[model samples]
Target: MPSEAKSWRWRYRFDGKEKMMSLGEYPKVGLKEARDRLAEARKLWSGGIDPLAERKAVVEAKEAEEREQQRRAESSFELIARDWWARWKEGKSRRHADTVMSRLEADVFARYGHRTRHLRTSSVKLNGS
Candidate 1:
């Protein structure tokens, strides 16, 4: 209990002849939520299911969702770059617009092709001569 007597720790007891379990700790896991989790574990244990494994599955699902969001960001670089060019062209001379378009299509587009399709179409309409 390392002096933090309030940390979530695995606890067990022997009720006469058989072992029983308890979840130790508070707000770190919250009182109500902790009770709910314990109720779930007890029910699952009675049914022969591992609560820890179930919790791990939930965590993995959440991690996958976060990874998907990151993929979208990486894939959106080209889109955002082209959108920036359109907004910038409004304030730039033709020569500046040409320079910006050349740099972006040459560098940014190739690097983020899969995500750049929609952006490329917008760029063509916005910069069409």
Candidate 2:
């Protein structure tokens, strides 16, 4: 153990190479947890799984999950509807697009507000112009 002014870490030799792993900070980790981590790393070595590789795999999986959740949130109805209108309005004159949007707001969106909670939860279909 190096007496440097940094967090306590575990180091060991494996396959003729020296490896280092953080057991966490000194006061927070304590001696017991560091020992536990050392034993765990040894167990990983015996099982033929490199501790560093295992940690990398776990981090990748967590990041992938977060990305998937964010994609779903971005695809929600309110956002998609606004995007669709923005694109569809581009080919039409401003006055015509505004007229069509106002009609939709008055006829379609207005109905949703007065609907019963149960009715609002059901599928809403818009007629194609």
Candidate 3:
């Protein structure tokens, strides 16, 4: 026997077109919750807002925020500089690479290691200007 699948859904018209939105599934969203969701959708529709579009906007905003956070985390100056050095140091002498890293640690990393590399202004000031 094929198991029956059940879900809660609501149908409504928006901009003269019919649309359906899923509230949730059986046992998870109960009858009361489904009715509440339907009422909320109806209220939004009456106010000229498309419930589906609103839901999509919220989802997109959340995804964009997550991407921005990940980009910031990956673009820190120390992370980017280390990645560059790993690739650039191939075939270079160990002493030369160590000297370069020592200078970076003493100078650049000390000042901007935790900062993201996409800053618009240089963090270091030249001649106190």
Candidate 4:
């Protein structure tokens, strides 16, 4: 985002409507930066995409990815377990799924609920190191 300078803002018209987008302040953004931004906007426009919409889409995607990453960090183990169970249970009988879930709760979740490092390993370590 650019700062405001001298009552002027970067303006462009799209679909018969005029829109203004802020580029940084004068001396901060200067002629080259404003030209660069205008060139970029024109590139997007030439590609048949609205610059503002494209920017919004990019920002939204980034925010969504960040939120998902934060959620995974917060409950990665549980998420992994649930995903595993979901895939494993597909086409299985309800009774069998219930029994398997109960056994996992008893034998796995309690011990590994807060300990996730081992969840990714293919075999158990024996050296205790």
Clashing residue pairs in candidate 4 (N, C-alpha, C atoms within 3 angstroms):
2-23, 2-24, 3-23, 3-24, 3-25
lDDT of 3 by residue, 1-129 (tens): 768768999888888999999998998899999999989988988999999999899999999999998888799888899999999899999999999989898988877787788764544454321
- For model 3, how big is the CA root-mean-square deviation? 3.8
Error of 4 at 92 (Å): 39
Ranking by lDDT: 3, 4, 2, 1
Report per-prediction Cα RMSD to one decimal. Answer: 9.3, 8.4, 3.8, 11.4
* Residue 120 of model 4, lDDT score: 52
lDDT of each: 0.66, 0.71, 0.88, 0.73
**Which residue segments of model 4 deviate by more than 4 Å?**
1-8, 78-129
Q: Please name the candidate that would achieve the greatest lDDT relative to the true structure.
A: 3
- Give a tens-digit lDDT track for model 4, residues 5-102: 45326677888898786655667677888888878878998888888888889999999999976765667565577678889999999999888888
**Which one wins on TM-score?**
3
Q: Name the runs in model 1 displaced over 4 angstroms.
A: 8-25, 77-95, 98-129
- Evaluated at residue 39, the lDDT of candidate 1 is 84
Name the 10 consecutive residues with the lowest summed lDDT in model 1: 12-21
Residues 16-114 of candidate 1: C-alpha lDDT, one tens digit per residue: 334334465665677777777678877876676565656678889999999987777665867677677888899689998999899888975675544
